[model samples]
Target: MPVSGTTKNTAYTIVASSLLAVCLAYIGWTWLMSSGNPVLTDVVLKLPLGENGFIYGVKDDRGGATVPFSYRYYVYRELTSNEQIASELKTAGPFLVTRDPAIKVDIQGSTINVSTNQEVYEYHSSTLFRHTNSNHYTPVTINLCKHSSDQPTK
Candidate 1:
């Protein structure tokens, strides 16, 4: 039994439409789940950690004229197995946010020290855990506007 040309065309159209709908739904879901809109700023710092990896900082432009800007930090490294380095690399973070415009990062052994205007935050390389089979790490967010004086009123 041979199928008609019109019938085959209909089937193809149905499959294509279903796939398009699924893709659109997934995109919408991803957009909805993300936090507030943040644009990557021009500020970036890099600290080399041997040949295997390095630590970096990227600031996000989240605040307007009334609110202070926020900065985020990250660490990146090449995956290794059996003492062999893999082409693929992994990243973890935006670990925390700071309001300082000029932040400094330094690496001492496996520990990364971040210096801000008010304080210094330290993160150990061993404690950073990227999701299995995924390059995303569990992010930590700290509140910088705890004091009423820092908050911007509407």
Candidate 2:
């Protein structure tokens, strides 16, 4: 037997509703997952790190103006040898984060010095939220010879 027009319409409605629900859920999930993390909207500075690496000073914005939701200075290290493409640099370590917008990073010999007016902040991410603490001194210095891990170093 052939299906009636009303039955066909009902079947179409059910499929459309299910698809719409799935799409909505996906959008909501994506937004909630990325809402707390800061987005790298702009790069403020780029400096040489040794001969094959680079130090980048970036502004991370969460689209707000207060702590935990504000724009901050974030420093990262990108090594050219780690990637297949020379021009496409991938940031390996998120070295530092601070409230001070102005940050200066310099490499002297085998040491990298990071200078900031405000205290350096560290992020501790739990299952649900992001926790931050000021646990570093200004003018932070790290010896390249001793630092090997990708973990953030003070």
Could you tell me every candidate's TM-score relative to the true structure?
0.43, 0.43
lDDT, model 2, position 85: 18
Candidate 1 ranges beyond 4 A from true positions: 1-37, 78-92, 119-154
Candidate 1 total steric clashes: 0
Candidate 1 on 62-101: residue-level lDDT in tens? 4668866665555555333411211122123455556654
After the best TM-score superposition of candidate 2, give how far the Cα of residue 150 lies from its true spot, in angstroms. 35
Candidate 2 deviant stretches above 4 angstroms:
1-37, 68-92, 123-154
Candidate 2 on 16-120: residue-level lDDT in tens?
Answer: 999999999999999988755446655655665444345555566565665442224323334233222122322323555665555655567535655555556
Q: Which ten residues in a row have the lowest lDDT in candidate 2?
A: 123-132
- What's model 2's TM-score? 0.43
Model 1: residue 41 alpha-carbon error in angstroms: 2.3
TM-score for model 1?
Answer: 0.43
- The most accurate candidate by lDDT is 1
Pairs of colliding residues, candidate 1? none
Superposition error at 97 for model 1 (Å): 1.2
Q: What lDDT does model 1 reach?
A: 0.52
C-alpha-based local distance difference test score of model 2: 0.49
